[model samples]
Target chain A: MLSSSKVKLIQSLNKKKYRQKYNLFVVEGIKNIKEFVFSNFLISNIYTTEPIPFMQEHQYQIISHEELKKISFLKTPHNALALVELPDTLPYSIQGIQIALDSIQDPGNLGTIIRLADWYGIEQIFCSETSVDVYNPKVVQATMGSLARVQVNYTDLKKLLTTSPIPVCTTDMDGENIYTSCLPQEAFLVMGNEGNGISEDIKSISNLKLTIPRFGKKQKTESLNVAISTGIILSEFFSQKEKI
Target chain B: MLSSSKVKLIQSLNKKKYRQKYNLFVVEGIKNIKEFVFSNFLISNIYTTEPIPFMQEHQYQIISHEELKKISFLKTPHNALALVELPDTLPYSIQGIQIALDSIQDPGNLGTIIRLADWYGIEQIFCSETSVDVYNPKVVQATMGSLARVQVNYTDLKKLLTTSPIPVCTTDMDGENIYTSCLPQEAFLVMGNEGNGISEDIKSISNLKLTIPRFGKKQKTESLNVAISTGIILSEFFSQKEKI
Candidate 1:
């Protein structure tokens, strides 16, 4: 049984402003909710059609399916939805191979990149202020529990690139081929917007520029998708590091 | 300038059943339409809100913005939309490094893979019968003009695998590390469904099983997105091929 006020609070998290105001975001589906239960993220509320273990009686609301639907954003609502408290935006302590985003607007792209970063053992991601909000519900759902593992910091990407102590690399059409280049073990890798490559301000300060060579015969493709490029580059970087 | 009958015909192309019945598909956006105009695809009718050069007056209908919105599937309609004649499905011919998809259900994934095939110079893609139709409007939109270059064929993927004349490679969790493997230049790379990867029948016939190494500590991530894995594996294959 869900109270009207509780339902309204869950629904409100869909908007960026509300999420910021409350410092809360929604994570849906049983699998995602289960992953969150074991992670370090603090769970404020759990609403489900069925009782789930590890959820205290007061913390969880065993609501009817209709009530669950009222709060779910999915077309077909998953069995459970959880409200998770957003972690504080801690200062980035750059370690190895940190990712910098230059105004990536798509929630799905940002989410997938975070998951990729988690897979490659990257600890931190620095997003330009214009990038999609990390707490967006769609992004949270897309991350598939990776949001708990990776730390994201929203900041001025241009300034970070200029002040970076290590080598900074960004992709370009005429840049050195990534396949042949010797990428550093520790560096800042910048990926850009879907429509535009890296911003001019950040691109100008980068110490290295790289390109993923096009193998197609006609080679008519404008460029690889930003997220796909990141995967390939990261794979190549680790493959090289492992070889040495 | 579009008649009621013509508008109805254009709008009907959105549905797969209707598209098959009429042998036509919708291609939106000025860049996409221009690519089709230059490619082998025959444009049956083009409806635009503004006059477009290089289009014969009789072949194009100058319609109001409201009329375009009525027929367009996109939330924000582009300047023009074109009805393209579906080319006949030609029999598959063996080629260098083909991609086979088994039950790939997402339109965006199918489309992105097609574009990725175009980028890596893979000329042909074979799809399981249950895979999403390549002509889906969402797919055509996501391809971003690469659909014009890559040839996609829907066929019995199992039969193709059994009869494959070259090495067949598929990704699995416990397979050999892709970095150290000697990937053949001519092969069929099979990527599986988003949730349930490579069907059992297809897996049995594969000659090579490769895995993309996960570098994350604890490695809680189950797997990379299918399309991202495709990019990584394809990059590795071509890079090795180029090395020799």
Candidate 2:
């Protein structure tokens, strides 16, 4: 059972203002809750329809499915919902090949990119301020369990790139082909918005502009999706490093 | 204003039975509708808030925004909606590079792959019958009018792969590294279910099983997303072809 205040607080996290004020974000679905519970991440609270044996170590409440559903953002609520404490703000540190997304507006894209970045062992992702809110229910759901492992920082992309010493790369159609391009091992790979590519100011700061070559005879579609391109780029980076 | 009967009929397209019975599907959004209207697709009807200067050449109705929203499947209704005649069943032709999705459940992934396939000039996509219905309103919206261009067929993947002469290549964790794998210019690339990899029977038919090499120093995420994997594989196919 949940107190009225608890339920209100859980519901409040849906908005960015509440999330920021409370320094907390929502993570839902049985898999995600399990992942967060078992991970090193700190969970402020857990709400579920039934006893989640896996999350026994956390502060939790077994509420009715109807009650859980009320606070769930999904159309079909996953078995569990959790409030995770947002990490204290950390200064940007240019390390291994980190992925920086400039104004990626889609929640699903940002989440999937976080998952993809996690798989490649890239621990940090920086999203432009205009990017979809990471704590948006849709983004949290899309990240699956990867959100537990990846550190996502929302910052002004233009500022970050301009002052960076490491080479910055932006994906574009007219850029040098990615296949033959010499991508540095430790640098920032900037991805652009869904409808628009990288902005001019950001593009100017990009030390290199790369493209994934299209081999098919047809040019029916304008561009490869930003999320899709990230996968191909990450795949090539890993494959290249292994050979060396 | 849309007639009540017409509105009910459009909403019915949400179900599989209604879709097959009417032999029609819906496409929405400003960009999608504009592209869909201009593309070679047959527009059975169009519902809009205002007269589209160019679309005046076609059959359309200027309806209230509320009326347009009534039949819209999206959270935010576009300015227009179009009922398109489902193309005739295509003759299943086996040749060149192909993509097969097994039990994919996400509409967004289904749509993005359709767009990616069109960009790569891949002619056909085969999906396991259990996959999301290609004509689902969400899927149609996400395809960005590429649905009209690509030929999608849903069938039993196990039976199809077993009988087909084309080499079946699948993605797996412990498989050959894709960068060095000599991929056939013409073959069926099998992408598996959202949560599960290729089934045993499908794996049995695979001529090659390869993995996308990960560059991240730490493998933190559970798995690379299926759609992301599909993009990486398609890009590699094009890259290999370009080198040749």
The lDDT for every candidate, in the order shown, is 0.87, 0.82
Cα miss at A87, model 2 (Å)? 0.7
Task: List model 2 lDDT by residue over A47-138, tens digit each.
Answer: 77777776453467777899988888889888888898887666657876878999999888898899898878777799888888888888
Q: Report model 1's TM-score to 2 decimal places.
A: 0.96
* Per-residue accuracy of model 1 over A76-179 as CA lDDT, tens digit each: 89998989998877766776788999999988899999999999988779999999998888898878878888888988888877888888999999899888
Show model 1 residue runs off by greater than 4 Å: A54-58
Best by DockQ: 1
Model 2 chain A scores worst on lDDT over the 10 consecutive residues at: A213-222
> Tens digit of lDDT per residue, candidate 2, span B1-244?
6889999999999998999899889988656776666666677898888777775645788889899889999898888888988777768788788999988898988998998888778877999888999999989977877776788998989898887778889988888888888778878999998888777888888888988876555554577777888988887776666657
Cα shift from native, residue A167, model 1 (Å): 1.0
Q: Show what share of the native A-B interface contacts model 1 retains.
A: 0.62
List the candidate 2 regions with Cα displacement exceeding 4 Å: A38-40, A54-59, A216-218, B37-40, B55-58, B214-220
Q: Which 10-residue window of candidate 1 chain A scores lowest in summed lDDT?
A: A216-225
